[model samples]
Target: MINRIKSGIPGLDEFIQGGFPLPSVLLVLGEPGTGKTTFGMQSIFYAAKRGEKAIYMTGIAEPVFMIKKFMSSYKFFDESFIENGRVQFWDLGTSIQTMGPKKALDAITDIVRETKVTRVIIDPLPLAQLFSSPVDYRRYLYDFLAALRNLNVFTIIVGEKADESAADLEAYMVDAVIILYLKSLDNPLVYKNLMRIRKMRGTNHTRDVLSVEITENGMSVLKLD
Candidate 1:
């Protein structure tokens, strides 16, 4: 039996066959304002609550302070975890800009090894693309992911949507791909949040788009026929 790492997102685990496979990297693709950060942070916090060490690393997303500020309203946002060091946040934006992708990867590997983190979140991972060509970025990702796998941690990489016609290298590399979108109905005024599990290796997961809601607590996947 494959070990699984529960997502901790309400009603989402059921769809992914109890959660993601252990030590697997998952790609969370969505546009801005689609709650991508929220999903990542919530998962880290949830793991921390279970006495597991977790880290949240931001690429080009908002700073750690702003992320905490925004998540403060959520029920799952616990300050105690941060205070006790069960959960930590780091910004890789400066490293990626100043030291470059290779150095950034080294920094991440060092932190994860030093902290012995079992879960990690890299928000807005696509920001690395700005610092390198497509080929370079892919090579960097391959190396970075290999390092993480050796550490044996579950990782979530949050990124923006890729063109449908093009192959998303990140998605292809990861073990699972979850896409989030905000869409309007016929009226164009009634908007809804939706989530889809496009790919999940080694698991029989649902492939349909499901309605979702971002509430005071966190995101919840709705049950739809």
Candidate 2:
């Protein structure tokens, strides 16, 4: 049987047929306001609840306190998870901007080395482009992914669809790719939240895009009939 890391997201698990494979990278691509950050938080929360250590690493607007605050509103997030030390958060925004790619890589290396991070979420990795050129960003991602492999951490690199090139670069670099799309249909009542498994290395993934939604509670997926 193939070992799968349960994501703990309702409908999503069924679509992936379990969860993400262990020790692999998954790219979560979406447009702005498409629940990309929320999806990452939920992934980390699920891992932490399952007695696995999870690390939330962000290169964008998400800060430590803010993430915690928003997550707290969700039933899955609580003080015990924090006090018991199942979850950790790191913001690379300032470090990446000030120290540059090499130093930023060092910072990332230090965290993975120090923490027992079974699941890692790097929110909006495209932000790395702001600190370095496209070529340099690609180089940094390659080296970073290599280091993650050595550490054996399952990682999620979140990206916004602001630039098509950035998304293509990330898809080429990661072990798996998941794209979230919001579509508005012609009918007034027609709308949809869809997720497609673009690629997952060494495993067969579903081709049809699955429907998903984000209500006041959190995200949910609906397996296609």
Candidate 3:
């Protein structure tokens, strides 16, 4: 039987047969305001609360202070986990910029193994692609995923939704692909946010476009049908 890792998002587990497959890499694609960061952070915080260690790594150079400030608004955000070392937040931007992809990968592997983290989030992974050519980027992803899988941790890679199709290297390389969309309604003045499980290997999952809401407490997925 394949093991599963709970995502910690309310109403999400039901769609994916209790949760994501264990030791799998998931690609989360979404537009700027579609709650990708919240999704990743919430999952980390949830696992941390349950006595599991997790890490949040951002490919961008944004300060951790700014991230905490924004996350503070969410009810699920817990500063204590960070303070107590149950959850770690690392910025990989400098490593990628200064040492390049090879060193950056080494840094990530070292950290995860040293910390014994069971869950990981690499937010805005598209930034890593900017540092390498398309061919090199694909190679980096292949190596990165293999390294993470070797650690037996559930990983989430967040990226902006590109104009490219699902066949895009990033989407195709991961074990699962989830797409979040913010679409304009008929009124034109309003928009509706939805999430879809584009592909999930080795597990049964709902493929329907489900409604998404970001409350003060965090995000919740509701089956539209």
Candidate 4:
């Protein structure tokens, strides 16, 4: 039997063999407005509430204060968790820009080791443009995830929606891949948020496009079929 970590997203566990497996790397791909960051943060807070050390790192333009300002609207954003030191938020944009890729990755590794974090999130993982070459990025992604696995931590890497070609690499390289989609409906007031699981290692995950709901309470699945 394998130990699993709860995703913190309601109605998501039943499909992914209870939850995410320990020491696994999960890649989440979605469009700009799809809520990938929300999913990651919700999971981290969930794990933190259960006494696990969690870390959320953003390697993009968004500031931590801004993330908190927007996230404060969600029920999953708990003040006590941050106050008590169960979860830590970090910005790797500057590190990646100034110190370069190797040192940026090293900073992450060092923090995780020092804090003994169990759950990790790197929002908008700089894959293509950040690296000088596609080959280098691919190698870095593989080795980075492998290192996290060896440390026995569950990691979630969020990124923008990738094409079919890029998606193939994402599926092959990560232990699991989740794609979040936002479809426009006829009415301007309403839209549909759907979730699709591209691949999940060692688990028979659903292939159907699952209906999802993103509310003040955070994200949840509406219908399995």
Task: Write down the lDDT of every candidate, Cα atoms only.
Answer: 0.85, 0.77, 0.86, 0.84
> What are the per-residue Cα lDDT tens digits for candidate 1 across 128-210?
45644888778878988889988989999887774343236888888888888878856588988888888889999997788
TM-score per model over all chains: 0.93, 0.88, 0.94, 0.92
**Tens-digit lDDT track for model 3 on 1-225?**
989999999999999999999899999988788988899999999999899999999877366778889988999998899999999988887777887777788789889999999999988674445645788777877988999999999999987774337458888889999888887767589999889888899989997889999999899999875
Candidate 2 error regions (>4 Å) = 127-133, 162-167
Q: Rank the candidates by TM-score, best first.
A: 3, 1, 4, 2
CA RMSD of each candidate after superposition: 1.7, 2.3, 1.7, 1.9
- In model 1, pairs of residues that clash are none
Better of 3 and 4 by TM-score: 3
Model 4 spans > 4 angstroms off: 162-165, 184-190
Q: Which stretches of candidate 1 lie over 4 Å from their true place?
A: 127-132, 162-166
Q: Report the lDDT of model 4 for residue 21.
A: 90
Q: Judged by lDDT, which candidate is best? A: 3
Residue 216, candidate 3: C-alpha displacement in angstroms: 0.9
Could you tell which candidate, 1 or 4, scores higher by lDDT? 1
Query: What digit string (tens of lDDT, one per residue) describes model 4 on residues 40-124?
Result: 9999988987899899898775888899899999998998999998989888887798888867877788888888999999987
lDDT of 2 by residue, 128-196 (tens): 556448887778778888888778888888876633344577788888888887776565687777777
